[model samples]
Target: PALRSIVNPDDARFLNPPDMPKAIQAFCRETRQPAPRTEGELVRCAYESLALKYREVLGWLEELTGNCIEVIHIVGGGSQSAILNQFTADACQRPVVAGPVEATAMGNLLVQVRASGELATLAEMREVIRKSSKVAVFKPGPAAAWEDAATRFAGLRRGN
Candidate 1:
């Protein structure tokens, strides 16, 4: 919010075309906005920007596949960040299912189990994961703000 007040929220962009810190500084310089000086601002900017990128990629997927993705299931360590999960839900206007922070380890164990012929198929592994894991669901909130943010991100990506 403080950062928004300092610059046109409409000018916000995802800062990943370059590496993180450099991209953020470059973007701030290009937009004539002050660079984020505090850890909170930097973290907020990165999280929000990532959420916008996720929305963009999801849109591309829907366009290319002719399928509507209703929910985003985020497994792995990244799913542990509730802030990111909420931001993703807001940005994508979709419910986000986040859990199994140890997804990689779980999958490795499952693969071994499957190789041993205890698990029959991928579906069986998924069922076991579902039964054993606890997941949190984040529902999309009011989307007007995120819609505006997305527009800004899109414009930035296009070098507008």
Candidate 2:
């Protein structure tokens, strides 16, 4: 809810005016839509907006690399948010693997282990972590709904 209040549909920081530094404040006000009144609505708006943004980024990456990104891995504390994880899957129409909630800490420890010569290769380190950690997976849902939402979000973003 806190994020929702600050960054409507999602944070406007990514929007490329470069000069405009606000979040979603100006966009919400300009859209003539009432600001989210309830906590649930606020959270929904925030998560949905974030998911849409993720979809856009994924598209850009795929376009740049000329390779399909089949999966999304959400690491660290953010991975623990089941709601957001599921939203990402739905919005991006891809599978999301969320795990190692304390990923940064584990990564640091892994670095030490590697330096100590315990793990010789990156693959070996990944295998060890894969065996030890518990992860949650979210699969994409119906395409129609997510696609429609994406279209609507794109329109809103374009000031339509």
Candidate 3:
């Protein structure tokens, strides 16, 4: 969380574009800041960038669907990262539900159980999963800072 205060997602130095070498060099030059040298810095940068990107994409999805996304459900191995989950919640201003780390295996088992006629519908299967799995919920934090960061992130996307 301390890193979130210092790391600006709008700063292109945090972004890992497809052409990484060229992009990092250009971003560092443009921002007049040294590139991330330590492992922790690099990891935090990546997490912040990813969280901002998620917020951006969620906006696009909401526009396309004409529906508000209340909560983000993150499964699989990625759900295990409390830091990333909290970052996502903060950046997106939405609750993040992360759990069922062994999602693939659980999904396969659920499908088999469903095929056996024990579960009558998809909702029933979902209920079973929800009841059986342990989940962590991260609610969004204070929005003022994140809102400012989001504005900068949007400007960055627009080539400002």
Candidate 4:
């Protein structure tokens, strides 16, 4: 079934949109997939798709930067999920360091501090965050099958 919650069912952004999780549920219903009522399923779909997109985008970034960047820092509420974090590490085939869950809040506060002449650049802000926040590191699991999932997800997108 076609996904129902958006003007374009092809756009995966409708799934677990940042603003409203309800809209995401509706998006699932549109596709005849089970509405992910539990936090785990909801986050699972969002994180899995996000990891795929991150890998895809990272490839584009690599092309643009002409460098193979292999580390990612995931900070925020979404980063709290060990399952999702490991999944991202696996999907991207890179080590991911996650934590400082209050990133958004910290960023906002940092901006305020900088604007008040208490800081200089984003680097300084990040230094402060490094001091203030706890971090957790994640390494890609032994799931070589994640590579297959990435291919399967791509196939799903292409309808092959």
Candidate 5:
């Protein structure tokens, strides 16, 4: 994940932070927990938390779609997180594909290309993605523990 409020997009933040590892460290300090100083630990915390939130969102998506999700595609700067992608696969119990870190621009370009008749169909767009960009595919792993972590995480949030 990256910084938000960059003039075009604005979004909001804590422990198990979705972004800002520094903020996560601060939260840990406030709670008398050891701060995550290493990159791996900080990233892990963020991934785990983000995975839980994504699972929650998927629950709503299922309600809207009225079916089980088949696959997930994560595109953007945040998609660069292998840890996050793996966690998403595990927690969401679905395959997660991440790629084209600059997907915003690429997707915009594709829309323009399609408008110009250079491409057609969403399937064709994805084929372009496969041939033209590097993607990381993550399969779901054991997620039983994530539920407990998520519950504790929710408690931390409720205290706020």
Candidate 6:
């Protein structure tokens, strides 16, 4: 909610800007909010900004595939962030599944298992992962606000 209140949406700087501190300052100035003074606050803004950027990439993938992506899967250490997962679902207006916190280690192990003939195919490996790992699901809320934000984000990416 705090993120929603401060988001300019139209500002390209929010799209993984070269300098986050500057972007935060600019965003605060534009939205008439005091600049974040604490690392936690800055981190929150950074997470929100990253989620919005993911939304943008999802759009590009959808366009290229000519198919709407139904769910987003986030693996690795970052997937542990429930806040970022929820933000991603909200920003993209889609379902987000985050888990396999140690994805890299899991994948490496899975590959070794496969090489040993324990797994016959990638599908089998996926099934093993699905059964072994726990995932958090985030369903999007209302689309109106996120849609508006996405539009602004797109415009920013296009340099409009």
Q: Which candidate has the top score in TM-score?
A: 1
* Candidate 3 colliding pairs: none
Candidate 6 weakest lDDT stretch, 10 residues: 1-10
Residue range 1-160, candidate 2, lDDT tens digits = 3223223343345456453323344555666644665557656767777888899899999999999999999999889999999989988999999998888988999999999999999999899889989999999987777787677667776767
Better of 1 and 6 by TM-score: 1
lDDT of 3 by residue, 90-141 (tens): 9899999998898899889989988998888989989988899999999999
Which prediction has the highest lDDT against the true structure?
Answer: 1
Error of 3 at 3 (Å): 6.8
Which scores higher on TM-score, 3 or 4?
3
- Between which residue pairs do clashes occur in model 1? none
* Model 5 residue 27 CA deviation in Å: 3.5
Score each candidate by Cα lDDT.
Answer: 0.80, 0.76, 0.76, 0.71, 0.71, 0.78
Candidate 5 positional error at 80, Å:
1.9
Worst 10 residues of 2 by lDDT: 1-10
Give all TM-scores, in the order shown.
Answer: 0.84, 0.82, 0.79, 0.68, 0.71, 0.77
Q: Write the per-residue lDDT of candidate 4 for residues 1-160, one digit (tens) a residue.
A: 1111112224656655765467667655755556767666666666676677777778889999999987888889978988778877887888999988988888888999999999988899889988988988888876666676567556556644
Q: Candidate 5, after superposition: displacement of residue 96 in Å? A: 0.8
Candidate 1 C-alpha lDDT tens digits along 39-96: 7777787788778889989999999999999999999989999998998999899999
Local accuracy of candidate 6 as per-residue lDDT tens digits, 6-91: 34445666678887777887766665556776777777766776778888789889999999999999999889999889989998
Over the full model, what C-alpha lDDT does candidate 2 score relative to the true structure?
0.76
Which residue pairs come into collision in candidate 5? Answer: none
Clashing pairs in 6: none
